[model samples]
Target: MSAVLELTGFVLTLGGWVVIGATLKNSYWKVSTVHGSVITSSSLYENLWHSCAEDSIGISNCRAFDTLLALPAYIQACRALMITSLILGMCGTLLTLLGLKCTQLGSNSENAKSKIAMLGGMVFILAGLSSMVAISWYAERITAQFFDSFYGGTKYELGYALYLGWAGSLLSILGGIFLTCSACKEKHRDYKYAATRQGKDARIYIKQSETVTSAKDYV
Candidate 1:
């Protein structure tokens, strides 16, 4: 049962990471203004890496930025953070796989395996947090720019990509939490078993000592 829970968490986390990566690559973090509820040429959509425009005739075009140095500080930061999170997620997934009870990679002992699983869970949690911060930071900047009265008349609305990011972050967090719980439960069981063994050994030692004393008194 615990193994099932761990696997479920791991799969969910991986799914979340995939979604986040796809969303980041997608040029739909925000969509340009819609006119009369219809998307026109001015309906531009953008993501961390590129921007796209949709025309009234249903033509869509996209272009990646030619340069990164020219990008805004928030954009640069978002890109960096998201990339970092992806890296972390990759590493965490490997660790989780190795530590899984169903795997024998690090199964020298249940205790050691549990520790590895816990470590993987921690990495996954960090990956989730990094992605969350990046997405939230980018969203906040957008919100600020949109609501700013001094800002130009050009308007943009939150896009599907942002929603995907939110969903991905949530799933990653939940999955990591599940994995952590499983690790903790394993650790507790290990400790309990060790204690039981120690108690039994102590009882046997006492019995041996009592037998020795009786033998001496009889002699």
Candidate 2:
């Protein structure tokens, strides 16, 4: 059961990273509003690195951001956070692979494997939080822009990429939690086994001492 849970968690964490990567690269995190009540409308879509506009005729044009320094603070921050999360997720995946019981890397002892798994879980948690922070920051900015009354209101609506980011964040968090729980259970079992062995050894030693004492008295 533990193995299943750990494996599921690892898979979910890996999938979450894939989702986040796609979200970051996608250019549809937001889409421009349609002015007409028409069923079909042309709109602009944008992501962290680029923006694309589509016309009613289905022609599309895309432009990448010219410079990182010229980007807004939120954009810069989101990019940083997302990249950091990706790096951490990669590290965590590596650690989780090593920790797997079927693998030989840290399989010398159950304790070692558990510790490695726990470390991976910690990394996953950090990665998840980073993703969540970036997404929330971007969402907050979008909300503020949308509600702005003083200036031209936000012309965009929340798009698919943002939803994907949210789903990925949730998966990472839940998977990390499962992995952490497995690690904790393994640690507890190790402690219990050690205590039982210690008790048995102590009993055997006491019996030996008593036997020697009785033999001495008889002699």
Candidate 3:
């Protein structure tokens, strides 16, 4: 690809990753903490009153307030956003790879810078995956505590989407680890097409060699 196109692809993909990561951080740490605290504090009063202990039942300000209430709304929103970001990232990665190929990027290619660009995308994917654990923990808590409370105080059952999101998050974590290693891999070899020219000592030669490139080149 031309310099202009290459630069554009890198900027878009990198920026998208940043946006997704920022969203997750804000939702999990900032929003969840403040809101979660309030919910927990309120629930203590209710728990004290509703439990088997008779003395604490009629105490003032005994209304229970479980943090799980604040937890679900935010968790659901975060899950939606995360799923969207994953799809978006996949698209951006594919486009970036195409652009790199256009610029003749590959291990043996003259324009090897494409490899680095690919590695950059892989890193972004890894980042997304790493955050999944934090998100999942929070999400599961929200669903189990808050959602289940609605149906006669039974343990809540996660819906299909919730389960899918959980599964996807786990997969993303694994994928990120895989990609991180793949991106750092240097010296990868593969078969190269070769043809022999007729001569006195003509013989077919099969070239097997590795391509070494840095992650930065893809960008």
Candidate 4:
């Protein structure tokens, strides 16, 4: 049962990691709002790296951010966070694979494997949190600007990429929870078994001592 749970968690975490990658590559993190506009000739969309405009005829043009230093602090922060998340995810995946009971990569002891799995789960959770914060922060900024009555800038709405990021983050978090639980369960079982064996050994030693005492008395 623990093995199954571990495998399930691994799959979920891996899938979430892949989804996050897709989210990062996706271009539409935000799109220009069409609300209160009667005629829309073109649509503007942007991601962490670039902005794009699509005309009514479906022709689209894109331009990368000219300078990293000139970009908004939030954008730069988000980029860093997403990149960090990816790096952590990769490390977590490798650790998880090595720790899995079904794999032969790491130590043969279940205890060691369980510890590795737990560490991987923690890393996975951190990765998820990092991405979640980045995506939420970006969305919050967009929504704040959109609802501001005095704001003169173009209003943008949340796009598909944001949704993808949210989904991926959630999956990664859940997966991490499962992985942690499985590892804990295994560790608990091992401890229980060790305790039982120790108790049994003590009982056997007491019984042997009693027998020896009886033999000496009888002799």
Give the alpha-carbon lDDT of every model: 0.84, 0.86, 0.42, 0.94
Candidate 4, residue 98: CA error in Å? 0.6
Q: Which prediction has the highest TM-score against the true structure?
A: 4
lDDT of 2 by residue, 129-168 (tens): 8999998888888767766766464466788889999999
Alpha carbon lDDT at 183, candidate 2: 86
Q: Which is the better candidate, 1 or 4, if ranked by TM-score?
A: 4
Per-residue accuracy of model 3 over 66-124 as CA lDDT, tens digit each: 55445445444555656565665665465355435344444545224445544555654
Give residue 152's lDDT in candidate 2 (0 to 100): 69
Show where candidate 2 strays beyond 4 Å. Answer: 35-40, 217-219
lDDT winner among the candidates? 4
**For model 4, what is the alpha-carbon lDDT of residue 128?**
92
Tens digit per residue, CA lDDT, model 1, 156-212: 778888889988988888888888989998888778999999999999999999999
Error of 2 at 80 (Å): 0.7
Candidate 4, after superposition: displacement of residue 192 in Å?
Answer: 0.4
For candidate 4, the TM-score is 0.97
TM-score of each: 0.91, 0.92, 0.35, 0.97
